[model samples]
Target: MSTASIPKCPMCGKPRSAEHAPFCSTRCRDRDLVKWLDDGYAIPAEPVHPFADSERDDAV
Candidate 1:
């Protein structure tokens, strides 16, 4: 395969390391984790009603 086709580190754009298949180094791996921990990424989701569950209660 061509080097151009090789995957790069998501955080720094460097070639990925064998030790860290998707990241070039532990730093990059940790940084990516930080992004996840800090809520830097978001998934496409349907907007949820704040009171959807409560509104369905028939007991009241």
Candidate 2:
């Protein structure tokens, strides 16, 4: 059995092969690296609420 049938890079959605499974090419891979360096992406620590936590608690 082989796992070579998958297509497209997971990061940039470009065509992928056995060689580059997650990125289509080195350029896309580097782009992701640059994004990290520039802080272009972020993961939220908690869900945002329009009202402050204290206000919500007071309302209840």
- Alpha-carbon lDDT, every model: 0.91, 0.76
Over 27-54, each residue of candidate 2 has an lDDT whose tens digit, in order, gives 8788888999999899968877777888
Off by over 4 Å in 2: 1-5, 46-60
> All candidates' TM-scores?
0.75, 0.51
* Candidate with the greatest TM-score versus the true structure: 1
User: What TM-score does structure 2 among the candidates reach?
Assistant: 0.51
Top candidate, metric lDDT: 1
TM-score computed on alpha carbons, candidate 1: 0.75
- Candidate 1 lDDT over 1-60, as tens digits, reads 888989998888999999997999999999989999999999989999998888889556
Model 1, which residues run further than 4 Å from truth? Answer: none
In model 2, the clashing pairs are none
RMSD of each: 2.2, 5.5
